[model samples]
Structure formats: structure tokens, C-alpha cells
Target: MKTCLVVDDSGVVRKVARRILEDLSFSVREAADGQAALVCCEEFMPDGILLDWNMPVMEGLEFLLELRKRDGGDVPRVIFCTTNNDIEHIAKAIASGANEYIMKPFDSDILREKLEEVGLIEKVDP
Candidate 1:
């Protein structure tokens, strides 16, 4: 199963993401902040990451920069998942190496679309 790291300060957000990713057949790992996410990454190389913007300890942008600085071949593709939907914030998240961005309070279909966009899901036979 593909592994996914979910980094968010909110426990509910983490649980929701974990459930969604697991439903898509991904093995989900969770962190409350960027610091914990880094540790999780070192321990296990995840195929993808879902990061939150406003977190305690280390924020999402800082985490992305740190991940880039590390010399590792198995760097996970990242998606910034947060409530912040400002144009500038979106640009910054993409600039910081996020492959995609997801607005919060997303429905199941939206979440599935994100997974498909990242090649984690395939289209079903009609």
C-alpha cells in the first residue's frame, strides 16, 4: 500500500485525512506539526504528504523548505491542505514545493479528485 503522511495541528483534521487516504488504500501516518512530520518522514519514506498551513512548532512552508534542504532521494510529493485560500498563500505553497493545494471542509469527491490528480487513484470503469 502507498504511504501518506498527514501533518496538521487539529486532531479532527488528521483523523479525517487519515480516513480518506485509508479509504483510497493508502497507509496513513499522522503528525500534529511539522517537527513531528519530519521525524515521521525520517523513519518511513511516505509516497505523499498532506500538510497544514497554520500549525504550532513548525509551519507548512518551513517544513517544505527543510524537506528540500535534506539530501534524500525518496522525497515525498506534498499537498498543502488548509483553510487558507488566499491567492498569495496558494502561490506561496506552490512555490514552496507543494504539488497541490486543498481547501478545508472538502467533500469526499473533492478529496478523491485530489488523490486522482496526484496519480494515487485511477478512474473507474463506466
Candidate 2:
């Protein structure tokens, strides 16, 4: 199973996202902030990351920059999940290597669509 790391400061958000990803058959891990997320990444590299923008210790953008600066096998695909909907912020996320952006209060269908768009979700033969 593919692994997904969820990075958010909100317990509720983390719980909901974890449920969603887990139900979709992805192994999920979580962290409360960017700092903790980095530690999780180092320990068990995930195939994708759902990251929040405003986090304690280090923000998502800063974390992305730091990851980009490193040389590794394969940089995990990242989806920015946040309340920040400004076009400039969206542009900045893309510029910083985010594969996709999902606003807060995300709908499950939209999240599923994003996973499919990134080739993370595939149709299963019955």
C-alpha cells in the first residue's frame, strides 16, 4: 500500500484526513507540525504528503524549500492543504514544488480526484 503523511496542527483535521486516507487503502502517518513531519519523513518516507500551510516551528513553504535543497532518491509528491486561498499563495506553492493544492474544509470527492490526478489512486478491477 502507498503511504501518505498528513501534516497539520489541528487534531480534528488530522483525524478526518487520516480516516479518509486510511479508508482509501493508503497507509497513513501524521505529525502535528512541520518539524515533526520532517522527523516522520526521515524515519519512513511516504509516497505523498498532505501539508498544511501555517504550522508551528516551521511553515509548509519553508519545509518544502528545505526538502528541495536535499538530494535523495525520490522527493515525495506534496499537496498543500490549508485555509490560505490567495492566488499568490497558490502560485508560491506551485513554484515551491507542490504537486497540488487543496483548500481547508476539503470535500472527499475533490481529494479523491486530486489523488487520481497525481496517479496515486488507480481504478481497481473487480
Candidate 3:
């Protein structure tokens, strides 16, 4: 199964995302913040990452920059999932190497769509 890391400060968000990702056929893992996420990545690089902004210890942007610098880091399809929906934030995320972006309060369909757009999952008919 494809592996994914869900990085978020909120337990509820992590749990929800975990279920959604699992339903999409990914082996899911969780990290409370970017620092913890980096440690997880170092141990084993996941096939994809569902990241959040405004996290403690290290923000999503910072973590993405650092991750891109690491060996094999470029392989993960990173999708930034956050409440920051402004053009600046979205542009910054894409420029920093995120494959796609998802707004907060997203559903399984939205997540699946973004994952497909990013090439992490195959497209499916509704």
C-alpha cells in the first residue's frame, strides 16, 4: 500500500485525515508538528505527505524547504492542507514544492481529487 504522513497540530484533524487517507488505500502515519514529522521522514520516507500550516516547533513551509533538501525527499507528493487559502499562501506552497493544496474542512472527495491531481492516487469516476 502507498504510505502517507499526516502532519497537523490538532488531534481531531489528524484523526479525520487518517481515516480519509486509509479509505483511499494508503498506509497512514501521524505527526503532531513539523519537527516530529521531520523525524518520521528521516526514519522512513512516505510516498506522500498531507501537511498543515501554522504548526508548532516548525511551520509547514519551513519543513517543506528542509524536506526538499534531504535525500529522496523530492519523491514524496506533498499536499498542503490548511486554512490558509490566500493566493500568497497557495503560491508560496506551490513554489516551495507542494504538489497540491487543500483548504481546511475538506472531505474525502476533495482530498481524493487533490491526491489524484498530484499523481499520488489514480483518478476514479464518481
lDDT of 2 by residue, 1-126 (tens): 999999999999999999899989999999998889888887887888899999989899888777666664146888999999999999999998889999999977778878877778885445
lDDT against the true structure, per candidate, is: 0.86, 0.87, 0.95
- Per-residue lDDT of 1-126 in model 1, one digit per residue for the tens? 898999999999999889888888999999999999889878887889989999999999898889877766236778899999999999998987888899998767787788778776786555
TM-score of 2: 0.92
Candidates in order, TM-scores: namely: 0.93, 0.92, 0.98
Clashes of each: 0, 0, 0
For model 2, state the Cα shift of residue 40 in Å: 0.8
Ranking by lDDT: 3, 2, 1
Q: Which ten residues in a row have the lowest lDDT in candidate 3?
A: 117-126
Structure candidate 1, residue pairs in collision: none
Q: Which candidate is the best by TM-score?
A: 3
Name the regions of candidate 1 deviating beyond 4 angstroms.
none
Model 1 has an lDDT value of 0.86
Q: Worst lDDT window (10 residues) for model 2?
A: 66-75
Clashing residue pairs, backbone N/CA/C < 3 A, model 3: none
The TM-score obtained by model 1 is 0.93
